[model samples]
Target: MTTPVLYLFGSAAPPVADVAGVITDAQHRGFDVCLGLTPTAARWLAPQLTELERLTGHPVRSEYKMPGTPDVWPKADVIALAPATFNTVNSWALGLTHDFVVGVVAEGIGKRIPTVTMPCVNAAYVQHRQFERSVSELRSMGVRVLYGEDGFQPNQPGQGHPSEYPWHLVLEAAVEMHQG
Candidate 1:
């Protein structure tokens, strides 16, 4: 039997520092992981790209491919956008495909693929009028958004600790969604 393919998408957020850990955790849980990063995330994780690719055995993608070009990664069985930034959440909700990460996630929702998102926004960003609405919109679209106190609560602005981010929960939520 083939292992489930998990497309792990990331944005520039504090928790992104734990990305390698998340990928390792997912692999141990039976997922063949592929990583997609928003441009900002790409820049943030640039130094570790080689190591990340080696760990996942797949290329780390941060840009859209040329028209008619074949995709290098396998089609995903599930998608988890961990360390999902405030901007990414809103963009996905607004159906904005300006970047590679948002574009794929937006398409995933349209395809009705089982998806999970764990936002890593701080208290200040969470207070924005659009944040709650964006989470609601994603949930209403059948995307499992792991937010609020039970999932990811807003930390004080600029006070988030990358080590404290619930990376495992993102993987667990995706697996549960895919199974159920």
Candidate 2:
């Protein structure tokens, strides 16, 4: 069987800096990982973009291609959005596909792609009523949203341990969903 394609998308969060490690981990788990990032995240990782492309053997996309342009990456067998910021989560739940990452994930829902998201937000952001609502909405839509005490528990602002993000849980869920 062909290796599963994992569309691993990330937003501008502290854990995003460790995306290379995540990609490598996914590869070891038998996934052909394609990396996508939010615009701000692309800028944050600009210096490492070339290296990331080499690592994934695919272009790291951050923007939507022009109209009628063909998609570059292979069809995703599973999608995992990690370090999803407050904006990314909210935008996707509301179907605001202004950005490439959010747009693809929103469509993934309709496509019935096995998708999972792990939010990398702090306790302060969680206080916003919209965050919880968005999470609920995404879950109701069949997207496995890994948030709360079971996954990526929100830390207090300024005390976040980005290195400690539960990437394994997200990857495990992706693999499991794909197998099912």
- Per-model TM-score, in order, reads 0.98, 0.98
**Clashing residue pairs for model 1:** none
36-99, model 1: which lDDT tens digit per residue?
A: 9999999999999999999999999999999999999999999999889999999999999999
User: Which has the greatest lDDT?
Assistant: 2
- The sequence of per-residue lDDT tens digits that candidate 2 reaches over residues 26-131 is 9999999999999999999999999999999999999998899998999999999998999999999999999999999999999999999999989999999999
Candidate 1 segments exceeding 4 Å error: none
lDDT of 2: 0.95
Which stretches of candidate 2 lie above 4 Å from their native place?
none
Which prediction has the highest TM-score against the true structure? 2
